[model samples]
Target: MTGVNIGILSIQGDVAENVSATRMAMDELGIEGVVSEVKNPEQISDLDGLVIPGGESTVIGTLSLVSGSLKKIKEKIASGMPVLGTCAGMILLSKKAKDRVVGEMEQPLLDHLDVKIERNAFGRQKDSFEADLSLEKIGISKFRGVFIRAPSVIDIGKDVEVLSRFNEKIVAIKQGNVIGTSFHPELTADLAVHKYFVTLVQKKN
Candidate 1:
């Protein structure tokens, strides 16, 4: 296959780790790809797939909007660009997000995924932890999921496919070309999720 260009939204979060993980994933899958950090809107045009890593949703959304990249990202996603959104990235991709104990949060979002997420559904930052996730569709039976101030999908649209659950809460889901996870896949050595995402990009190309 030709070299697939994968972009990681670098407005904030674990950008370098995602880049490394993605590159490793491509290599592990015997695929050709270049992983790059995307900080400008123009870069979205050359991307075969995008990853929004775990970070502060408000900060990521605000910076992307300020840099004029948010609109471009939405356009690309609308045009079938595959995206893997983790943690805060999942929040940014959701149609709605609210505080589990407080109420709704007024953060800027991509609003492409038709899921209602509960911000900090797992717990606060201090409560961050890792657990084994069973994502059968992606062919993983016990993938380690690292959650840090993660959010949970409280509601999902008809088109959404629930990939994994923890404590009966939706932790991972897929909607068309978009995949959202409440945990950070890059934080672990297993690259199953990243490999799956790279395959999505490969298929799209």
Candidate 2:
């Protein structure tokens, strides 16, 4: 509550949107915390939780590695720090990724979550769409999900828990301290996902 600090990887993507949604989620839950955009590796140390937003995975991964933040984030996640990764963020957190429309892609990934993801599995940027998800584990029956050039989990390891699915495809998953979603929860008015993530942070803190 009091000393909770959440960071959003700001290398690219919906950095501001995630921050705003996180702050709103904290407020709605009557929790106290600070949400900030994290750019440098040093910023990762003080964070109780982290959010990797939806954006270009290649660019975000390249920039994070170059800045040395990728290693730090990997270390933090391995150390049991709660993380919420959306869309491209989900790709980075995945153990492996392949481009469904384009073919195999060689990109940097944290590989924290034990799941195989298919990049652009939902379609291209123009194919971005919205759907309602039933994340019963997170206490939500119908949550609006925004899919923008999204990826879906094609394979999941035993440790991974499928949170939500679309058309029988895995769209959201959780494993220990890491949460990954192919859809962008920050793009919608619903704060359930963020709130669930905040609870993860709170439990960790």
Candidate 3:
């Protein structure tokens, strides 16, 4: 079996950890593939899937736009490229992003996922917490999710499905081939999330 080629957006934040988790997941699944940091849009090609890691959303988005990667990302997503966004990545994918303390910031977004998000919805870094996510709707139950300065899904379009939740708030969601979460799955030893994302990538491939 030809392994899936997964690329982690290396623009900023948790890139190395994501890449490691993705590789580990693939190994556990006995899938042959490579996971590496992708800094340019040109690397978008031949990638079975892409991961937008946790980071400063505004900075990553602005840098992507400035570096001409925003359009490429949009194009890939529009063409049905499977993507998994976590943490600040959620803000990049969201069509609407608001601040929990403030309200909105001037940040360029890929605008692929149809949802409204609130940055730092969980408060400060000290408010970072872990919870057993209810992702049973997607055949996953009790996923240990780590949320750090995460964003919350306030509103989503009808096409979006709630994959997981915590404290009555939407944390994990799926829309078509795109999967987004408010937590950092890579930070945990559990590889289920990455494994699931790889499955999505395989299906799309």
- Count of steric clashes across candidates, in order: 0, 0, 1
lDDT of 3 by residue, 1-205 (tens): 3777899999999999999999888888887878888877788765789999999998889898988888888898988989999998888998999999898777899887889998999899999998888689777777899999889999989999989878878999999999999999999998888999987887777
Tens digit of per-residue lDDT, candidate 1, span 87-121 = 99999999999997889888889989999999999
Which candidate has the top score in lDDT?
1
Q: Write the per-residue lDDT of candidate 2 for residues 1-205, one digit (tens) a residue.
A: 4668999999998899999999999999988879999999899988999999999999999999999999999999989999999999999998889999778778889988998899888788799898888999878899999998889999999999999999889999999989999998898888999999998899889
Please identify model 3 stretches exceeding 4 Å from their true place.
none
Task: Report RMSD (Å) for each prediction in the order shown.
Answer: 1.2, 1.1, 1.3
Q: Model 3: clashing residue pairs?
A: 3-32
Displacement of residue 157 (Cα, Å) in model 3 is 0.6
TM-score of each: 0.97, 0.97, 0.96
With a 3 Å backbone cut-off (N, CA, C), the pairs that clash in candidate 2 are: none
Candidate 1 minimal-lDDT segment of 10 residues: 122-131
How much is the lDDT of residue 131 in candidate 2?
A: 80
Q: How good is model 2 by TM-score? A: 0.97
